[model samples]
Target: MSTTFWIILAGAIATYLTRVGGHLVISRFENIHPRVEAGLNAVPAAVLTTLVAPAVLGAGPAEWAALVVTALVSLRGGLMSMFLAGAAVLIIARQFVG
Candidate 1:
């Protein structure tokens, strides 16, 4: 009924359709070329960099410290561990550094 509900519903439908379309297209392909495979593999990293670059570039000292801690934890741990490590570092930095 509300505009926000419609917008959310449309976004969900678009996301679902995009995912299904991608799977359908991939399934039809018998074999992927090496170059295409490499490109596909690089997509996640590229998207992650695009998402994080702005925040890392513009953030305050606390956020910068959190990013460093998160990167270090990510090297040896899973996503949850990395997230917790980053959050903890941010909290500590905010309290003591700010």
Candidate 2:
């Protein structure tokens, strides 16, 4: 095999081993502390906000408008309303502007 192929294969093997090792090591820790578990659970919301905040704030007027519309719709209803609001806002913005 070529040098490139060998390098890629080695990288894949290393990645797989690291993931397997992590699972094995973590599983051996019989009891997770409650505070640590709570912290881990909060991570998802933190990550979601971190990713969404920048785009909603930094992007131009169109994105800001869409974010506001989505928030209002979501508050009124729920996830379904949020999805519809985003799609409608995006379609309208694209049609009118672009």
Candidate 3:
């Protein structure tokens, strides 16, 4: 096999072994700390918020204006209204800016 093929195969095997080994080792633990468990439970929500917050808020003035409009629309109308606001803002921005 080529060197690249061997490297990829090794990486895949290593990842599989690490994941399986982790599960095996974790199963042996009798008790998980309550704080750690709580933190773990919160991790997914935190990650999702981190992922989405930036996309919703990160931008220049035009983007911020659109986000504001969307938020207002969302509060008054619904998701579709919010989407329409964002799309309308983007179209308006493109027309004016570029």
Query: All models: lDDT?
Result: 0.94, 0.82, 0.81
Candidate 1 to truth, TM = 0.86
Tens-digit per-residue lDDT, 10-88, candidate 1: 9999999988987898999999999999998999999889999997888999999999999999999999999999999
Listed in order, each prediction's TM-score against the native is 0.86, 0.60, 0.46
Q: Please give the clash total of every predicted structure, in order.
A: 0, 0, 0
Q: CA lDDT of 86 in candidate 2?
A: 78
lDDT of residue 98 for candidate 1: 85
- Could you give the candidate ranking by TM-score, starting with the highest? 1, 2, 3
**Tens digits of per-residue lDDT for model 2 on 1-98?**
89999999999999899879857976999988899888878978998999888776777666666778888888778898898887788778877676
**Highest TM-score among the candidates is held by which one?**
1
Candidate achieving the largest lDDT? 1
Two-way lDDT contest, 1 vs 2, winner: 1
Cα lDDT of model 3 by residue, 1-98, tens digit: 89999999999999899779857976989988899788878977898789768776656666777878887888789878789988899779867765
Query: Arrange candidates by lDDT, highest first: which order?
Result: 1, 2, 3
lDDT of 2 at 35: 93
- Higher-TM-score candidate of 2 and 3: 2
Q: Candidate 1, overall lDDT?
A: 0.94
